[model samples]
Target chain A: MEATVKIFRFNPETDQKPHFETYTMPVESTDRVLDLLEYIKGNFDGTLSFRRSCAHGICGSDAMRINGRNYLACKALVKDVGLKIKVEPVLGLKVIKDLIVDMDPFFEHFRSVMPYFVNDEPPPAKERLQTIEERERFDDTTKCILCACCTTSCPSFWANQEYLGPAAMVNAHRFIFDSRDRAAAERLRILNDQFGVFRCHTIFNCTIACPREIEITQAIGELKNAISTGALE
Target chain B: MMQTRVVPQRGFNLDYIMFIFTRVSGLSIVLLALVGIILAMVMGARTQMDLGTLMRWTFFPNPNHVVNSDIPDVTLGWANAYWSTMQFLLIFFAFTHAANGLRMIVEDYVNRGVGQLLVRGFFFLLWLFMLITAIFVVLSS
Candidate 1:
């Protein structure tokens, strides 16, 4: 089947404004959207640029708006998005070039959440351990690839870029709920600010837009629950 | 693993206050509406008032408030008996009703990149305007 891929193009140095350039090419039903992008870049226009590390969707370097929804290009197949495809850079971020967004703000929010283990205690004789149930408590949030898909799709983030976004909260949730981590209090303090979990508004766009299918809204609700009730359960 | 049973409590902030306020306000609204409906029913609304009058009574309960004199000598109406309750109800409930309803619609339809920032800014100002105006009206009256 022939697929028409319209790519959002912009170069700050050259183009006065952003525009879309369309390419028609043959594609199989099983071919990934990344394949279509590669075809366009390889044959149609070498100047076209997009981020993609592992074409298998693990790297999460190619998250974009495909057909008005956030999805990983390498994960979305041609048949799923139909023949006529419209691709654009993810929303709520500064676009550097064609299909490339500045992810500094996103990473900054992630870092602010302290998305790491912080158990300041005498080193256990050997290593710390966790129960299966405790691990399962926050298992869902462990799959975040830092794609910014969920964060970019959030309307709250679009409205207020400082809202920390869903991806950061999910990363926070991962460590906050961990029975092995002791920084939950500090993280909760940060999240209690104006740009924290309270800004979520329960929109659920982050949950739907997540390519990994992580229950982003549920994780946020859990974070809110922990803050409100002061109980991790 | 660290002893992680309960996390820290949330500190005070407008957002946190409003977060809890939103939940409590929702329940208060239902309770207030129930009180209004029951009082209206008990006040012989079934026998004397039509469904429209009962609904108006349930909502504002001050059927003649719109036309009532600002400097009336004495409170003289079925709703006047419950004046204080109706006063508090009319102030906060109405504000939350309209503001939260608008928030729901805006959050539902105008989500994502399109019109998000514009709608959010517009709603915030509208809420602030409504709050200040309501306070002024209450204080002046």
Candidate 2:
């Protein structure tokens, strides 16, 4: 199959504005978008820039807006991307070059939520073992990979760059519900800020855009309830 | 499943009341303001038209022409301010209320996982987006 990949191209330091560069490549239907990109970079154009660690979608390095919606290029099939595929860096992010975006803000928001466990209480000498039932409470939350596909797909982030975004909050949720972790109050206080959990509109776009298929809105709902009811207190 | 307490219920009573009030008040005020503006335009037109034409419409009820001492000049300043304030209030309340409602929806749905993390993060960003947009428009205007 032949595909026209119209990728957004620009170097912020040099180019005043971004322009689209289309490359027509003959590809097989079974080929993934990453495969095509690799082919282009290796054979046609070496200037093209993108990130990809695990081609199986575990490492979400190749996330971009493929033909509008956000997805992992490595996971998306080239034949599936319509005739004219427009690949651009995720929305509400600064495009450093071709398909790369500055992930500093994304990481900042992640860190702002205090993603690590904060247990002040004395630890049990033995393993702070939790019952299977207790472990199940936060079971769903531990699936996060810090991939920004969901955040970039969100329209809210498109409008406001300051939001803590969902990924950080979800990470916080993982620890918030853990029986061994006793920082629910602190985490809740942090998530209670203006740009925290309250900003989510539950549009479900993030959930849909998520490659891991994690139920994001539900976790956020739990967090919101926890914050509003002063559960953390 | 672990025996975790259910989320604290924020009943629909307050939400329903606010929704109804905003919808009713906003619609009424906007409509009334439009009517007032139109009436003022018509009155202005009548005053500017030829005396004969003005009299034709003004005298439809065989109105008493004793340029009354009891009549007060109608100034729309207070009305305009009142109406505009009402409109702004309704919009402000409605927008925030709706935003909160959607936030609640998010809390009710997204489960913890990569999907949850990415989605909630995305939602937070979106909230920030709307908030900033609202602020910018409010401030610049």
Candidate 3:
């Protein structure tokens, strides 16, 4: 299959603004989008910069805006690009190069929520005993790989840049709902702010864009309910 | 280096307080509107005043009377009562009701980027102005 990809190009230190450059490639039907990008970088233009570690979606290093929607480049097939592809850096983020964005702020939000299990009590000799039901509490949220496909797609994060964002909220939910985790109250307390869970307008874009298929909006709704429930109690 | 932390709980009491206030104010507006409608119906348009003029008087104190009486009696008649009731309904609901409503709209129209921001911004400003005006009138009265 033949495809024309209009990729965004920019170097912040050199260029005043980002611009698009097109590359036409003859690709195989079963070839992934990342393969076409590699072909372009090697055969056509070496300046085309993007991040890709694993050829599969597990690494999550090659997330980019492919035809007005964010997706993992490694998983996206050339056939998925349609007639023409207009690729750009993820929205609501500072683009560093062709398809790379400065992930500092994105990870900063992850750090801000302290996305980890926090139990006040000391660990027992073995470990906290748990049934299947207890383990299922955070199973859905444990799928996030920090790829930032969900957060950049969120409109609430676009409006309020300081918003804890959906990815972080999902992480917080993972820890908050854990049976072994004893920081539900503290997590609720942290997410009760104006730019926290309440700021989420319940737009399902995050959930839809998630490569992990995590139900982000539902998680945020649960967190909002938790905050109010905690406040009342 | 020592780590600094800020929790949403620290500043969240105010949001909760505001949420409660907004709910109370919203309910009060509805109740007041209902009362004004009942008052208008029961009292009838006895005074030789139009609806708009009457509404102004209910919200704004009547400047016409300058009686040297000891106790100044404030009477809210039909026209004044209904207009003020409508104004209160508009002001109180505009902020709390409309702001939340637009948040819903933003959630609905996700793909339209600049258009959504522009419309939401306009609604937000309108709500802010109406809330301020409503507060001013209520305090003055």
Candidate 4:
């Protein structure tokens, strides 16, 4: 199949404004959008830049706006996006180059949630034990790969980066509902600030844009419920 | 399946409080409208007034709205202190609910710094002014 791909281009050192560069190439129906990018970068312009590690969607590095929606380039099939595909960097973040965005602020918000486990008591003989039901309470949010797809697609996060976006809330839900963690209240306090979980308008954009199929809006709702009713079960 | 792992409850800030208040006040406004309709029908509105008059009283519940309608007398049923209180309550809920909603929208963009302060101050005064004027009209008329 013949595909016309328009990839956003930017070079801070060379150009004052960002622009788009189109590539017309023949690709198989099974060829993914990432394959098109790789082909373009190899044969067309060597200066094009993007981030892709593992190329299998596990690393969450190839997230970008594909046809106005957030998706992993490796996972987006050329056949699914039709003959014409428009790819750009994710929204609401600074594009350092073509498709590579500055991810430091995103990671900063993720780290603010205290994503690690916090149990101050002495260790058990082997590992912390948990029931199946307890594990299922937060099983959905554990699939988040910090891809920023959900956060960048959120209107609230786009308006204000200070607000703790949906990704951070999902990470908070993971630990806050764990049966072995003891710092749920501390994490709740951190999220109870002005720019916390309440910032979410429950528009479901984050839920729809998640490539891992994580129930991000529902996770944020659970955080709001926990903050209001103080219930983990 | 219960609050086995409980989050410590603390006094929530204005945002969470307003989030819950928006829901409660929204329901309260609906209930108030229903109450107004019931009272209007009970006082012979169904027989004595048209649909426009009945609908007008359903929201405002004032004598001025019904005075020029098919209803002959407006001294006792629709023009008393009780109806004035209802009008005040309706305006209060609707205004406060909408004002807080405006703040929620503003918080989406301006959560910090001078812009936040300016929007907060400006919208608050606007809400206050509108509310006071509504209250005066409700009581005087």
Q: lDDT winner among the candidates?
A: 4
- State the iRMSD of every prediction, in order shown: 4.4, 9.2, 11.3, 2.5
Ranked by lDDT, the better of candidates 1 and 4 is 4
Candidate that beats the other on DockQ, 2 or 3, i.e. the better one: 3
- Write one digit per residue (lDDT tens) for candidate 2, span A1-233: 68888888888778899998888989888788888889889988898889889888887788988989888998888667766778888888888898999999999998887778776778888878788988888788788887798888776676667777888888989888887776677777777665677667688888988888889888888887776564521
lDDT of 3 by residue, A105-182 (tens): 899988878798787798899988877766776689999988899999988777656778999999998887777766
Better of 2 and 4 by DockQ: 4
For model 1, the interface Cα RMSD in angstroms equals 4.4
**Residue A148, candidate 3: how far off, in angstroms?**
0.5
lDDT of candidate 4 over A3-55, digit per residue (tens): 99999999999989999989999998889999999999999988889999999
TM-score per candidate: 0.84, 0.65, 0.71, 0.92
Model 1 CA lDDT for position B131 = 72
Q: Write the per-residue lDDT of candidate 2 for residues B76-128, one digit (tens) a residue.
A: 22234343443344344445555555644554455446875676677667766
The number of the candidate with the highest DockQ is 4
> The CA-based lDDT of model 3 is what?
0.72
Show where candidate 2 strays beyond 4 Å: A231-233, B1-141
Ranking by DockQ: 4, 1, 3, 2
When just chain B is superposed on the true chain B, each candidate scores a TM-score of 0.58, 0.33, 0.43, 0.83
Give the Cα lDDT of each candidate: 0.83, 0.70, 0.72, 0.88
Model 1: per-residue lDDT, tens digit, B34-64?
8878976675566666677666656665545
TM-score for candidate 3, residues paired by index = 0.71
Tell me candidate 2's fraction of native contacts, as a decimal between 0 and 1: 0.06
Q: Give the top-scoring candidate (TM-score).
A: 4
The clash tally of candidate 1 reads 0
DockQ scores for all predicted structures: 0.41, 0.06, 0.09, 0.54
- Residue B34's lDDT within candidate 1 is 81
Q: Is the docking of candidate 3 incorrect, acceptable, medium or high quality?
A: incorrect
